[model samples]
Target: MLKKNNSTPLYNQLVDVLIEHIKTNLDIDEKMLSEREICLKYDVSRTTVRAALNELEEMGYIFKRHGKGTFVSGLWKEMQNLSEAYSFTEQMKQLGKIPHSQVLSLEYIVANQDLAKNVGIQEGEHVYKMKRLRSADGMPMMYETTFIPAYLFPDLTISKLESMPLYELYPQVYNQDIKYADEEFYASVLQAKESEELGLPAGSACLRIRRTTYSQENKIIEYTLSVARGDQFVYKIRHSKK
Candidate 1:
């Protein structure tokens, strides 16, 4: 039973209690308890229970599908921070899995207004577009496309990407410094083409992330579109009030 504690917020206390239950593998298949059930079992108000649930959802410990109740994120989901910039290779390496990238498309295209604006190039400028399927331990994980100003990397080729991660290529071949990036993310359904390429279920829910990376001079050097498997990735962001 939840006895109100002045030292910790009531909602936080409830969250801790629920986390304990989850860690001990209790009632997981019964993935979620209803609001009323939480209130009755924990002797907490609906507001308190909701707060706890929201916290858990934000932390990626659980996810609530629309029209479906919340469920614990399975072990297959990779925990990641939304605010950080990481290559697919680096992420897989951190998880102790072998990373491989298969080139899907590599070409140069005249930048349109939208593409130019995102990568800080003029319209009609040339950009190199590279698309690849990223795999972890031989399992497909993400499909990604990156657009880079051709002028900034004049000598790049598909062969270079085949052998190393983008970050490795940046400093060695392009002589450019790789810096942080701004990213935005949202939930989306996989298109037929994407589903086939990634071996995901047709119309499966996925995470769509877009990013623009900058150099030390604040020049936008690359723009990337990444689609990650919903069942295999979970993103987290921390919040602190100033």
Candidate 2:
């Protein structure tokens, strides 16, 4: 039951309640309750029910079929546009999801030949290797390992990492701003350990992304390799007419 005196608006509260039901109780393309039925069941007015349903439709949780009715759509799969630079935390926030990160490991290591080549640094240079699991609304979404040159971020620490997103930290804590990034994506099956971290069965289909982030000075700042759950995301690219 929704609290009459609660701070949240009735429509927003209704949206939350309906989303839970859709995610847990309904299947894809399943018909949802009519606005009148929702109003009766939730003890809310038609205005409140309509407001909530409009928000759900705009968010891609459900779709209306005119005279037919509303039906469940995607299971809240995240949509990502590859044409723009994005941060995982920022993207989740835009989608009304709570973003979380688990620092599985953080240590300093010497860059190997391939790693050095990827980051454009000397093979023996020291780098901070960070392994993290990224989640949205307590659901595991991706497992990633990142390498940042130690000399550029010598003061990086676990406490600082836990405080905010790495992209935010770069400028706030280190006075370093990202200029741009180059990325490559590949289709692959999840490894046993990676699947364990993402809460998926081993050999599950996954998307692997390699990113090289650069500073304004055209120097490589970070290199990250990420394994993401295939069902949880949709990546899009917009091409322009040349």
Candidate 3:
């Protein structure tokens, strides 16, 4: 039973009680109690239970599948070093797992005005657009789309990408050295279309990352958008007092 004697608020106290139970006796493979059940057991309102659940979810202690209830997700702590600039293949390689990209769609496309502006290419310029579902140990990890300036690398093909990392192939195929890159990251709920491609529940939380790679001459050579599983990946930034 959760004690009502804490400096913290009731909902926070309830959240701690729930976490304690999970750490003590809850089997990781078993589904957690539903909000209604939790409320009834703890003598709290549904609103309070929802509040506690939201906090636990944000802390990555639990995850909910649409219509499937919540479950413990302790695996997130192991994948905390996701802020580094490593390709899916390279990251998994460091973790001693083979990485593979299942090519979803690849084609030569005329750069639309929106894509052209973002990638620093000419509008209507030819571009090689590719989409792939990245998997590690046969489990889907990310859905990514890439746009490369075809004028710079006309030989782009899905076959080549499937066998090699983009960073490794950039110098060889296009002779374009990657000097630096800029990336932005954010959290978002999966849209219907994204959920379909990534095999996640619609409205599921996910991480959206956009990155642009540059050459030594300061030319933007590649732009990529990636959606990763929220429960399986975390972006960490280490800081030291200056």
Candidate 4:
């Protein structure tokens, strides 16, 4: 129920209520209450309900399907804050969603001069190149390729990589403490292969995330390129006053 005499507009109040419900009770693709249902349940007019729903849609909290109804969007389904370094597996766990990664391939390759310099390694140094598809709650969200300096993880194996997120093994298994990470993201379209792996149509808009992980001594640990479906991800960057 809404406070009819409150200073805030009825529709605005309704929007806030629905946002709370979305965060606590809704899942991606779950159907939302119809305008009629909302009007009756919240004791608001149809106009007010409509306005609240519209606001939710505009904020990327919900999406509508013609001939059906509005549903929770993937935007609120999985969120990643770029303000801090992140681990996909740990983040999903924090959100109470199961996280999984499928390793598509792994191979040893000699690094080119540019690649070596970028990762703080010697030219022609061998590296482990890996491709993986990552998901949350069984929904494909990102397809990524990672490069790790072979010299750093000499005992690295495909089986070990499949067992857990690469970041988790840094300190526990490899005795390498993470110093920090640098990340950059940009808008792009999914390529054919990437689209297929991520379960999206070719040419679908995507956000490309490039990250480089560093060890305690500032040595590059790994470099990764991740492609996240634009529809399924909301990237946030926080700013602070200096």
Best of the candidates, lDDT: 2
TM-score of candidate 1 relative to the true fold = 0.65
* TM-score pick, better of 3 and 4: 4
Candidate models: Cα lDDT each: 0.82, 0.87, 0.83, 0.86
lDDT of 3 at 75: 47
Model 4's lDDT to the true fold?
0.86
Judging by lDDT, tell me the better candidate of 1 and 3.
3
The RMSD of every model to the true structure, in order and in angstroms, is 11.4, 11.3, 16.0, 13.4
Cα error of candidate 4 at position 236, Å: 1.7
How many clashing residue pairs appear in each of the predictions shown?
0, 0, 0, 0
Clashing pairs in 4: none
For 1-242, candidate 3 gives per-residue lDDT tens digits of: 76667678778998888788887877665699998999889988899899999998776678888898999877436435544556678778877877888889988999999999878988999888888898888888899889888878877777787667888888987789998888898998899998887788999989998989899878888899999989877666655343
Runs with alpha carbons beyond 4 Å of true place in candidate 4: 1-85
**Model 4, span 1-242: residue lDDT tens:** 68899999999999899999988898989999988998889887899898988898767789888889989996743333442438888777767889899998999999999889768899999998989898999999898899999988997888999776788788889988999989899999989988888888999999999999999988999999899989977767644343
- TM-score for each model: 0.65, 0.65, 0.63, 0.65
Give one digit per residue, the lDDT tens place, for model 1 in 2-102.
65757889899898888877767744345677778989998888998999988987666776666767788642134453435467777677678999999
